[model samples]
Target: MKSLPPLGDDAVVRLSRQGGVAAIHTLTRPREIAFAQCNIDQRTRICSVLEGCLAIEDPASGRGDQRFYEIEVCYRIGEQDDRMVMKVPEDRAPGELVHLWDKGEVL
Candidate 1:
C-alpha cells in the first residue's frame, strides 16, 4: 500500500488523466476507476470510464447534506452484469441510481 495525497476528487481525476488507475478500499467497500482516454464534464460531474460513463451529483434537494450523492450509470459495458452495478452500498442510495440500457440489457 502507498500513501495518497488528500486532493479528493480532483486528485482522482488528475491521476486518471495521467494514465494511472486508482483502487480505493474503505471499511465499507472497494472501488476502482480507470479514466484513460475518456471524456469528463466537470460541471455535470460525469466521467467516462472503462466502457461507460458515470454521473455523480449532489442533489439540490439535499442541500446541507454532505453525505448525499446521486450516481447514475448511463450505460452498460460489454456484457457487464447487473449484479456488479447493484453492489453499491444501500446507504449510498443505490435505488436512486438510474441505469440506462445498453445492447438490450439494463445497466
Candidate 2:
C-alpha cells in the first residue's frame, strides 16, 4: 500500500454537524471530494495516519471559525486492478494515483 502525495496545503476534511456529513475542500476548490457517510471514521483514521503529509488543523487549537469538528487533508495510494473502484469527479481526477477510499475491501 503505497501512499500518495497530500491533496494540498489548503485541503480540508470537514466533519459536518448534520448527519456527520464529511467532505474534502481546498482553498481554490470547495467540496472537491465527498465520502460515504459510513466511512467517516475510516476517513478520519486515514487522515490521522497521514498527518505528516497533510495540512491538518484542529478546531480545538483555536483555528478558524468553521463549525466543522476538525480539518484535515486526504491522501491516496496506487491503484490495483483487483480492487473495486470508486467514482471520482471528472474535475478532481486522481490521475496516476488512486484515493484510499477508491479501493473497496479485497474480499
Best candidate according to lDDT: 2
Instruction: Estimate candidate 2's alpha-carbon lDDT, on a 0 to 1 scale.
Output: 0.31
Residue pairs with colliding backbones in model 1 are none
Question: Which lDDT tens digits does candidate 2 get at residues 7-104?
Answer: 43333343212111333343213222344433556555544434422233222431232222222334333442121112222233222112332342
* Model 2: colliding residue pairs: none
Against the reference, the lDDT scores of all candidates come to: 0.25, 0.31
Give the per-residue lDDT of model 1 (tens digit) for 1-107: 12112222222221110011332323213222323323344212323221222232222423332233223222333543221121122234333122211111123
Model 1 TM-score, all chains together: 0.19
RMSD list, candidates in order: 15.6, 14.8
**Candidate 2 regions with alpha-carbon error over 4 angstroms:** 1-33, 36-38, 55-107
